[model samples]
Target: MADVQTGTRRAAGPRDTVWREPAGIGQTRRARPEVVRVASKAIRKSAAIVLLLALWEVLPRLEVFDPVFVPPLSENLAAWYDLLLSGQLLEHFQASLTRSLAGFGLAIVLAIPLGLLIGWYTPVADLLMPLLELFRNTSAVALLPVFILVLGLGETSKITFVLYACSWPILLNTVSGVKTVEPLLIKSARSMGLGPIRLFQKVILPAAVPTIFTGVRLAGAYSILVLLFAEMVGAKAGLGYLIQDSQSSFRITDMYAGIITISVLGLLFNLLLLTVERRFSTWRT
Candidate 1:
């Protein structure tokens, strides 16, 4: 009987001592909260968007506002769809995008380097500060006539206006970012015998990146706003022109469609910048 009992008993093994989870249990434990978090955030954003759309759709129908002024959301959507199908929307969008992007790109290329130079050197900042302050304080729109006159009614004028509008925010933010780097960090880097260029590249630039990004985001928003105004003032094919034309023609729905398109485009541009900023800015995390 003892021999038979001993034979039935299992031998002690590594598997017996080790705690083993079922497949996927660990992953589920780790991923579940993240999934829930993302889903909840998405649900909240979607709910807000849906509620706004519902209000937009219902308000005009209720006759509280003039239907002519605030066309039903559905009508605007239908107009947008029609425009899209006819390719008119695409043409205007492409034209606007080209001009806006061209101006924004030029602004970035010019502003960042000049910002760095001004921020790094006291003499340069002193020399440029008064003129910069004057220009920055002046309204971008106020300079529109000057640009149109100098650059003429060509694409160059429109792009130049956008560049001027975008430059101030980027330049200001970059200077602020560079100036705000911790003095202790600079001292520590100097103590380590890091050269000025090396210290700037390794320590200063990294520290300044977040603030610079803030300026870049501001510039991006400014670029779109200025571009729209420039387009509206004088353009044959752009969303601004579309809106102007529709308004003149009393095509309320078409005008709303243009407005909606620009709103969406602005939102998309901000989202794109945010994504890029987050990708490059892991240090903030």
Candidate 2:
């Protein structure tokens, strides 16, 4: 009987360990509670933040870095407070916001239609994409000198430069969005006998909404980035100019404060875009 059993076991291919082991499949199977999973993730994230703060505190306290070169959080806040009290900080903040919004608006106006055109027609894409890529590759800073010469060191020049830099993202995203609409969707619309305009209205635009929004978000980021340089070059007011001036005068606190303000503003703008994206992309889910 033992020999027969051994032979029968040998005839069978390898037994599944998971099925054979007494405590294997059931006990080894994952059964993490939702609470534990959430708690673990939260713990990891909190630990990461705490680690960063600890490093920030320790690095400056040790003076391993030059105090002048690296202003600690406290010193930077003090400088920010001083600027806040003087009202200079607010003035610059407003100027930067104004320029960024203006430039971003211009980019939206120009990029959306162009993107749609390119996405809809292969010929348009073939002709224009090369030129777009060429211009996009060229540094915005390289064009700054020409803009300054043509538009002067005024609000116009600064905002327009921002628009020029920010437009590429919006345009590219829009084109991609339109081009990437599901072929089935287009075919379905055609089978329904939808006209060109109706098809674009019903299928293309809705599908492209997410992509268009992506472009807008990217443009928003570039708006601030380009505005920073614009403000730095020759602006009497703006956060970029404020930072430049502060650094020039060795007011490290003010410089740090300006940077903080810039970061906060940029974050807010990004949040605004994200909110819009979520609201519009609800259908995707």
Q: Output the number of the lDDT-best candidate.
A: 1
Clashing pairs in 2: none
User: What's the C-alpha lDDT at position 160 in model 1?
Assistant: 94
In Å, residue 222's CA in model 2 sits off its true spot by 1.2
Model 2 per-residue lDDT tens digits across residues 1-285: 123222223223556432233434433343455468668777887998778656655687799767777767777888888888999888998999998998899889988999999999899999999999899899999999999999999999998899899898899999999999999999999999999999999999999998899889988888998899888888999999998988899887788788888987888999999889888886663
lDDT of 1 by residue, 1-285 (tens): 123223334545767543334545555555657677668777886998999889888988998777889988999999999999999999999999999999999999999989989999999999999999999999999999999999998899999999999899899989998999999999999999999999999988999898888888888988888899988899899999999999999998999999999999999999999888777676663
Error of 2 at 174 (Å): 0.7
Alpha-carbon lDDT, every model:
0.88, 0.85
Taking the candidates one at a time, how many backbone clashes does each contain?
0, 0
Q: Given candidate 1, what's the lDDT at residue 131?
A: 95
